[model samples]
Target: MKNTLPIALSNRHVHLSEEHIKILFGEGHELNKTKDLSQPGQYACEEKIDVVGPKNTLKGVRVLGPARKNTQIEVSLADGFTLGVVPPVRDSGDLAGSPGAKLVGPKGEVQITEGIIAAARHIHMHTADAEDFGVNDKDRVKVRVGGERGLIFENVLVRVHPEYALEMHVDVDEGNAAGVKNGDMVELIK
Candidate 1:
């Protein structure tokens, strides 16, 4: 039988408001805004940057929405960098006791506001794919991602719908830790 499992890298991300963006990036730093259909009061940034987390460094994170009282930064896999570990996506306000970050530019040093690490893990599967896997929305299970950096991820929440294809979602920190990338294979580890 053919093994449908493949290793896929995952990344973490968070939502922030314009005001919080100013607090984090400082004044004059640009914040791009894009609407998100999946979440209300959610948005995506056209510009991307690097965010350092507790265990690893995350590159190409697109900030979403305007800064709110409780804004968050989303960290995703580098798509190419391999640190052999996934860095968790953290809230800016929660980075105080966690790792700090430096904006990759002439901007010099940037301070993290929060210290929370480890975003929730979830899987993305289409309605048909979900049926194929015999899983449903909110179903929790373990996924075995195979490759040089193979790993069995547990407690993965399932999100099933028509708009989604079969895929697992992870924050950048988690992706880095697990060494995941796009087109990587992931199998239900049950």
Candidate 2:
């Protein structure tokens, strides 16, 4: 079976905590869906905020919903430099000892002690898709993208879930370095 997945370029974004959402938006506020994301039941919300990093502030960062137990900020390496925080590359929901930032919203601001990160590249595969690829959850793999500017990405995490969509997620920097865009196919390198 062929082992390939479409790449999904992930830009700078924030996933708010339920407590923070109410503080930022208001009491009993909910995010509005701007568009559906590749992941099933996940959508881009209309809410946006500014994250104040150590050295600089980044504005217009979109917030994804629904809220989680804790808030997390995902940014590219370039963004980390702009904010002057060296974020560790980690999988989603793993924020131990990661960076933190100040988030400014319309209604209020949140000073987070930790939760910022440069998200590690990963592939979201359905259970059947993982079987086809011969991979398991938490496994690290390599991905090859070919073109005028080809690149091989290592340490790509494989996340397999029944509800996952078959897509590789990379930040803007990684996508630009490979000269790949959203919907570009990448072959798995065992």
Considering every candidate listed, which one attains the maximal lDDT?
Answer: 2
The total of clashing pairs for model 2 equals 0
lDDT of 1 by residue, 1-190 (tens): 2224433443445455454455556667776666553333446667555655444556666665555565444444342133223335432344435323443322333554542245457766677777777778878889877667778888877777777655566665566667777666667854
Runs of candidate 1 with Cα error greater than 4 angstroms are 1-13, 18-44, 48-61, 65-70, 75-117
TM-scores, each model vs. reference = 0.52, 0.98
C-alpha positional error of residue 88 in candidate 2 after TM-score superposition, expressed in Å: 0.8
Give the alpha-carbon lDDT of every model. 0.55, 0.93
- lDDT, candidate 2, 1-190, per-residue tens: 8687899899999999999998888888989999999999888999999999889999999999778898999999899999999989898999999989899999998899899998999999999999999999999999999999998999999999999999999999999999999999889999
Candidate 1: residue 3 Cα off by (Å): 8.5
